[model samples]
Target: MSYRGPNVVATSNADEKTPAASRDNRTRSATTDFLDPLTETEGLDLVGILSSVDETAYVWDLTTGRLDWESNAAEILGFDDTRKVATGAAFHALIAPEHLNSRLEVFSRSVGADRVRGVPYRLQYRLRPCGQRSETEIRVEDQGRWWPGADGHAVRARGVIRIMHEEYLEQQRQLVRNDFDELTGQLNRVRLTDALGAVLTRAEREYQPCAFLMISVNNLAVINETFGIEIGDQIIAEVGRRIRSKQRGGDVIGRYSSNKFGLVMLGCGPGALRVAAERFIKAVRETTIKTSFAQMTATISLGGVIIPDQAKSVHEAVNFALRALDIAKSKRFDCFVAHEQLPPAEGARLRNKSIAEGVIAALDDHRMRLVLQPMVSTKTGKPEIYEALLRMERPDGSLVSAGEFVPIAEQLGLSRLIDRRTLELTVDLLKRHHELTLSVNVSGLTCSDAEWLTTLRRLTAGNPDVLRRMIVEITETVALEELDQSVNFVDTLNELGCRVAIDDFGAGYTSFKNLKRLNVDMVKIDGAFVKNLADDTSDQIFVKTMIDLANSFGMETVAEWVGDERSARFLKDAGITYMQGYYYGMPFDSSDYVKAA
Candidate 1:
């Protein structure tokens, strides 16, 4: 066994009282199989194998002021001889400057006189290759322990050092790829959400205004169909590049989806964010993008909303931006839309968000209740079918109306829950009152939603009589939008003995051809026209035309929002068979309905 080097230090003052002979004996015993390069025993041979690989075995003899390094250490440090790399400071020099101190601390703990026996020493850090910038650093994994003399003073430190540059770089690349979108080289959805969450938290803490912009390339599908997907991809890439170029220094930008980019701007209020959104829209619209087969200018729509002011979370902010973006796309091209502040009566996006959250919580807690508004037969002047409406019981003991939360629920995709709940409640109500009939409003989405369809099948199949008493009222807009699905749905309902009614009938431009094909049982005149039927001759004519059309198609007509006696009388004289509004009776909850009965 031998130890050879000039870089190690002798045990310091703490070990000065130990006899020289005793220290020599301890050093000899500790260096035995560890220093014997040819030792073939299990642990001894393990060191030899490690040294043969890309790892180096090193030993610092504290008592002799020497350092011994194996051949691998010299090779890794780009030296032909061990001496060139064996100096005490040479290893420290190879470490990146930022890591040098930490590396030294680990070493100090392992070899320091005060360090107790069995204290572990392990460190992983980057090493700057000679003549290269710090950016091109390599990783080194070090593990070793300090051994003490019989007198209890540390005299030697030995360990294995592995060059892990390639492995570490591969790991880093994999991590980056996971966090970023490959095509656009921008943060992907998951990573973008995490980044936004962090920014939101920080902004809240600092009381700074932050904003989010949802930028979408308009009609990307049309481009793909016309020019090919390759050209569409090129356009998307170019748009990402332009967004990156225009984004401010501290702003965070990411590819939120295939054709959408998300931008988080710090210190931006509503006005500043609107200006930024305008610039972004102009930048993309003005830039000419060249692809392999085509060159064209692309238009973008941007929706921006101030954080904490417009929304409190990434989910809410993104939703608000998306809503604004939808409005922009529908209203104008190559334009920016900022979430607007509206009068309290209008119930802006934030209010909708609050309502949505409350609706979700209420649904989770089974706090939603059904109220029925009676629809009276104009000819008989008697209540026949009661329209089931949704109401939510808030935590504050206040009740929210159907008009307030129904639209918000649909917007948040929570209408499916409301529909299912309403169906269940209506079925229970019908079971209790055999002669009672109820018209339930269902989202057009339910016709195609697999879960809702399955649920409907189950509920109706249980009792065919319940189906006979149910009239499913679907909105005219939805019926027209999902014409094919709505037609099939109405047919299915009719086969189940349930009648179907088209709601808000006058709002949409559904043609008579499509109307006859739907085979619905009734048309509920939209409140917009019926509300002013008493005074407005145009509304009067519109309502009369709807009734005549319904009668011609063998479908009954129900006038909605018949709030005044004049409106009801006008609707009745105009041949409306049923009327629904405060003129009949305001919507009443089940408890009130039971008491009234």
Candidate 2:
């Protein structure tokens, strides 16, 4: 046999049957015989499978410069079955113009390299079939190898092409589902965190600035309870819509939590972020949410800090915002508070963070302790009840006061834990000492929490005696914010033989209006008014008015922050029935106090 081609070599099989020649020819013939049946079976299977799958198969006769494909190829290309073959030029034209050069380069390199290495050629490229106006595109994976004919003069390329349209579509759908929140169609938390981190890293690299804001729909739980969950969802969706509409370019927004969302503003300085934060607050506050139940206006609170400078990581940035949001909620709704507005010292911030962490640990480890601050009754001139105060035992044998960590616990949504802990401690203490009466303070947030209410019910169910000696102090802020719930709580406590006190009574602005709604046994005037009772005339007047109001309502009054005998005498002469302050005694371990008595 003889061959004449650029990639072909000539060889002879005409020699007579010499022993050496016979062995060599027999080896070649045996190899050829083995491959013939294998190739025939594979080719038939490939054809059958491709035809059944409605796929395309093609062969390139390199010597004749012809491209021939299976009949289905014409249909796949949006053409008639009659045109099942094309020359190289027509085959090349099937590729999209934009992908043509790149496709050709890839094909050439793949084939050339494989040919050098005696390997098969394979590639994937985008194809927009020619002679059609459908404008549809498909990804085709080509697999081919060089094949030589019997004469060694014909070189051909055979391959199979598979369309990847379905695969590509599925991949796109998966990406969408992964990155988007199904309820609000916003970025989900995981993707949002990733994007925010990316932006933070880029901003740091470029020496730019960014800001993050954590926004929450205020009292979403109340809305869900009053209306239905459907209405609450509509409110959240509307909030997302308003935020998207008001977003500046390059701002990323995501659903951070159930009722909270986050915003990332790229290259935003503090002043710019403040203005933007105000705008966002206004936008959501002004938009009225229309649900099936009723139309309602909602307010959102924003708490955030500048990134890359103030916050070094995503977690820190979010914590900064969370800390601010806690302050905002404490002050008023529809407000924006930046992290810098908090304590300026890094030590303060670290302490707050550590306190937040300690709360979580304390909840799990049962490390919460209670102390008793004696409340002396002027009528009896002796301590009648002790206020239960929360203290966290530190790892280093120290204690953290509630004043330092209670707000943090509230901010971190651990108030209910604290409330439950207090109840447990109070129950234990009351069981230990039959003569000791104790008061425990609960946050306004806890008053509205269903879990906390359940906990309260459970605590009172087993031991009715505990309720007789227990005084549950609901803060003035909580009572005012959730007046209806607070009233119900007070009524339930009274019915159970438990006394209720309006704690920090004059701290909130709605004291006068809401105090009448609360049918309680005692009112603890806020320490702010009592702290300066000896000198400040206005403080004295406020305290006097509060005491008179409580007396008129048939509620006993207790004055706090009476730091000296003068203040104590002042409260005593003002008809304050009880006095609790440093002057009487500081908070001491409740267990020890009960034991000493």
Clashing pairs in 1: 5-66, 8-65, 8-66, 9-62
Query: Compared with the true structure, what per-residue lDDT tens digits does model 2 show for residues 303-416?
Result: 888889998888788888888888887765588888874446875768667878888898788889988899999988899989989999876568989888888778878887
Among all windows of ten consecutive residues in candidate 1, which has the lowest summed lDDT?
1-10
Please give each candidate's TM-score.
0.43, 0.42
User: Over the full model, what C-alpha lDDT does candidate 1 score relative to the true structure?
Assistant: 0.78
Reference-based lDDT, each prediction: 0.78, 0.76
Over 21-106, each residue of candidate 1 has an lDDT whose tens digit, in order, gives 65455444334535564453544654447655577677766565445565445566454444433434555555677777675555
Candidate 1 TM-score to native: 0.43
Clashes of 1: 4
Question: 350, model 2: CA deviation in Å?
Answer: 6.6
Model 2 residue 156 lDDT?
63
